[model samples]
Target: MFTNPEQFANATKTLFELQMNTFNALTSKAVDGVEQVIALNMATAKNSVKGSVDAGMELSQAKDPKAAMDTAASQVQPAVGGAVAYGEQLKVIIEDIHKEFTEAADHHMAEAKNTLSALIYDVTKNVKPGSENAVDVIKAAIDNAFKGYEEVTRATREAVKTVEQEIAKATAQVGALKPAPKNEAAE
Candidate 1:
């Protein structure tokens, strides 16, 4: 709906730049997420190897089979706890990425909508008298499109909230299941 060739070219260039910027931001975010996951995995692997070595030593030093069994049993709870903590960390990373992406997208979408509205308004101002009805119809369509976008955005936000709540609940449950004291186990 641009009036001049220059206007159309400028608009096209602006849209292209916006898309490129968005792509770069998303790619950077993905890379960060990957880095986090790699770091976490490396740390987890290191600790696991150390733990295994230490456990082996402890078992080797045990005077009897029963003592070796006790040593192994003592490591179970901590291993499970570590696993749960790792899962929670992953969840946090993923949620953070999703949030950042959503915020960026929302910002870009709003900017685009405003730009489009302004362009439409400018174009409509130059229309002849008989074309008023067509302009009105176009404006109405644009309004409806915006309304639809808002509704979808709202629903997506609600869904994200629900998923976050569920993850929190599950994490809490796992956290609550700490191992009982050795003395208690004896009883």
Candidate 2:
């Protein structure tokens, strides 16, 4: 449809504008979700440690060590509660983001596919029965589309693997660290 340079430039500009808007909105949502998660985690971690130690000290004054430990255990419940809340909140936020991103990607993918389809159609519409150029162009477009699909898939897999590895490493580090004692949990 964009036969002239001017029309092509305008179309490109419009596409870029739409892409920028989508990108900015996605980034904003992601940043807000991350910030909330970080804040919630920090607060929970702080309170869990502090409550464990303070309760431990208060309970330690009691004559029974087991009862004192039980009391301290009851005091350090923020982590579970916070994690539950964070999980639910983060789930919704992440789902919303995924929906937005998927919708955007689908829109672009469909458009690209359509454009290629139309280009091939146009090229073949008037070609001689054995036109070499038409066959070559169609083959090239198909190959390019397949390459693009594979690249996107590979990148997605790598990103998922990287995130999983980082999560595992963090978990291992936390597990390796010596847990806080009844009196020194926070400190």
Candidate 3:
């Protein structure tokens, strides 16, 4: 539909630049997310190693087998709590990354759709008198494509929301973990 080579080249260049920008933004987000995860892992690992060494020392200092067993048993609740905390922290990181990625993608998609629609409009404006039907057909096809894209995006968002809800529920349950009452354990 382009009337001139120059116009066509310009449009192509615009599209290419938009796509490259989107790609770069997404890549940066991914790198940031990975860095956050790595930092969390490193911190968790250090704490875990320290906790293990302290627990070992306590167990070793026990005067009898029963004391040693009791020392080990007391460590269970803290270990579970630490694990739950770590999971929650990881979840937060992942959710943040997801939110940022979704925003970036949505922004890019909107920009692309607008740009393409404008380009199409510009190209169709100088149509030959007898080519009105062809222009209409082209416009209809583009409209339908955009509509389909919208529907898919909506469904995907709902799916992600449901998944996030489930994760929250699971995390809550894990966080609620508790050791049995001392009386009950004694029985």
Number of the top TM-score candidate: 3
Worst 10 residues of 3 by lDDT: 144-153
Give candidate 2's error at residue 64 in angstroms. Answer: 9.7
Write one digit per residue (lDDT tens) for candidate 1, span 1-187: 3457796577557656755665576568768867988998899889989988998999999999999999999888887788778779867976996687678668766876786677677658778767778667767765665566567657666766787688778778777776766787665
What does candidate 2's lDDT look like per residue over 93-139, in tens digits?
55555555555555655655565565555545555656766567655
For model 2 the local lDDT of residue 79 reads 47
lDDT of each: 0.74, 0.57, 0.80
Write down the TM-score for model 2. Answer: 0.49
Sorted on lDDT, best first, the list reads 3, 1, 2
lDDT of 1 at 68: 92
Candidate 3 off by > 4 Å:
130-173, 181-187
Shift in Å, residue 131, candidate 2:
4.0
At residue 98, candidate 1 shows an lDDT of 69
Clashing pairs in 2: none
Estimated TM-score for each candidate: 0.71, 0.49, 0.77
After superposition on all CA atoms, how large is the RMSD of candidate 1? 3.8
Error of 1 at 120 (Å): 1.9
